[model samples]
Target: MSGIHLAYDLSFTHTEGRWNQPGAWVGSDFPDVKMFLELARTAERAGVDMLFFGDGSGIPSTWRGSIEPAVEWGIQWPRQDMSPIIAAMSTVTDHIGFGLTYSSTFMHPFYVARLLNSLDHVSGGRIAFNVVASSRGADAANYGYAQLADHDQRYERMEEFIAVCRALWDSVSPDAIERDRATGRFADPAKVHPIDHTGEFFTVKGPLSAVPSPQHHPVVVQAGNSPRGVAASATFADLVFGFGGSLAGQQRHRAMLDAALVDEGRDPAAVGILWATQVIVGRTAAEAITRRDTVLDFWTHEAVGTMLSHNAGYDFSTLPESFRLGELREEIIAANASPAGFIGALVTELGADTVITRDEFFEHGFLAASGLDHTVIGDAATVAETLEQNHADTGARGGFMLSSPLAMPSAYAELSELLVPELRRRGALAPRYPGSTLRENLAV
Candidate 1:
């Protein structure tokens, strides 16, 4: 087995009211701080590599069958902020790396540089940034834009934005800071360089206000999964997330990304490829299947529909279960051209008869129902073997960003207790975090 790292998705804001039934659980039922602390402890104790938070600026109005909007959809609405939460989590855990998603479209590069630098110091150098170009109109409205920019245009702006951020981060060298008590002098002026950058999208002046971080720069994680997204990842990202339903499909995507990195004059080994998998582990295959079925029995159809509606950019709730893939593909293409163009082609290649019922889409991707890929459900040893095989076959450096069934903490416990130990015994998963910094853990 190659280097296998673990990451768990932490969503502080729980979707309780969105369900049709009144008895469904929500954020109020489970406290975010408690959940976060538990997850941090659990992951650290299990020797997990990282804890990643997926965030968004706004909720889609179509999610609740209302243009007016009923529930807070994304991270910003539920959590309000992430930096503070990450700071708290960092203090509570010892070794696990921390990561959060931030958009280049809405934030200033200097501010982002300063904040991320501070996070790196606070986390003891365990920090990563997942760069994204916001696609929602609501997020654009908050930033004073009339509408969201076109997909390609956003990516182009992102390229300049990331460049400016990197320059700002490198402006102040680590040796520049000197706490000289006798002369009361701090930070030598000679070592601090000003980034007087004037780009197409932004103009920034000078060094970041914060001192240089231990990691030099936060690990860059990109997850666009489109042609333009792949190109950007090749140029900028240290790790790129790939989307697919099978090992073969994932390998093809990985090859494409690797080729893109080579074309951009980057070392392919420097960029890790991580595939998303929803995991279900038990003592045996039968036990795992039973657990999965039990969870599916209680799965809320309405909640699933709401999530799909937000992603597909239309209310899938109203569509018939027997809706043709061709019709849905055309509709999605007409609505949001870029995501549909990329996703539609991939979906067709996987197989069009892949019916995307509300239940199936939420369980994993639409094609997961075929059992070809997506969710990895089996006993501890079986799941470990599969992970080892996939890593060996694909040359993917990172491990599964394990998506749980319902609650973040509960799902984490299952993986840590069952799958992780088995992988360790097989010499697949790391026995301990190899280094103090996020980069070291990933590189190991």
Candidate 2:
């Protein structure tokens, strides 16, 4: 089996320390650039595969309300841009891959291709693209659209968008440049092909402005679990991100993705699977539990209600907290009939009693076990052992994308000091990066 590909989902605007706090955005703090560089270096030393950013173009008014209330009530908030920070981080770390999230819905394919190509060059082929079709309705308006595109339509546009980008990358071959200074000739025009791509969503005239990077193209990653989302990923994604309440559930998702990939005429083995996880580890299980509970206690019912309302796009505040689970599912179905089926499936699996009220849901959501397939809160060796079992049982391509509940740097520091060394001793972690590019690291 392949080794675990560990990664940190860094938020430029949503800093790591406020992860468990409702309405807390990590990126807002503008954590010292030096701090980010050091953290990247730490992950590298700890044998992480990549340090990635989760981003959005605009904040919705609903979320803004939550933030304002939290601020007035003396709560924490985080926000920051991830692209330039990763670029800076790359200069300070040797082998770790850096990823930036860019929405396919807002940006042009030509611009995205050129920007990422330059980043790949600057980072020496250690860059990746986390493609997203923006979820927030306000974000679309901010970008000059009257309303956000429907979820399925966004995926349709993304399909054509990615195809064009790939073609643009192929347009300018690496060897196209001649650089004959004496003759005042630079590149071989004949070698640089014109894409002349015309598609349903996008049209490009010629080759990309920038040359292809050493990695050839940045690795493409997708993070969505809906049916349309699965189809989009199956067609182009190199990695798929999934969320589940149990190991069996995660395995089911993996099977679904594999089937989708096979349908696309792509080898399932070529794509990697990463589960999102939040781990709180300490010297003892008791210590870990205490820490986890402390974070959960900070989350209030109002905060959770606000967060969920924004996510579901229906005001849950007006609804009764004592609303029955069946009633809530029906309400959700009425509001967004598309994802209702998936939501209903989750509620059924977790059971009505297990699902919490709007207020309780926010607090419960912070609990590692509530959302993650595997939650490790114990001694280092025990944590490492559980990870090994998970890998063996599921045959997942990689490990979790670690989420820090609080103090991003400190959480990672603990991971480095406690978890990493033990994993190495047990031969579950890599002592050094196996290759130079993100593709090579993930593929291996």
In model 1, where do residues sit more than 4 Å from their true spots? 12-31, 63-80, 297-301, 315-342, 350-373
Task: Choose the strongest candidate by lDDT.
Answer: 1
- The ten-residue window of minimal lDDT in model 1 covers 16-25
Candidate 1, 437: how far from true, in Å?
0.7
User: What does candidate 1 score in Cα RMSD to the true structure?
Assistant: 4.2
lDDT of each: 0.70, 0.69
Model 2, 150-259: lDDT tens digits are 76888898888888889988998889888899998989888798899988788899788887798878898887667788889999998876663477767777887889
Provide the clash count, candidate 2. Answer: 21
The local distance difference test score of model 1 is 0.70
TM-score of each: 0.85, 0.87
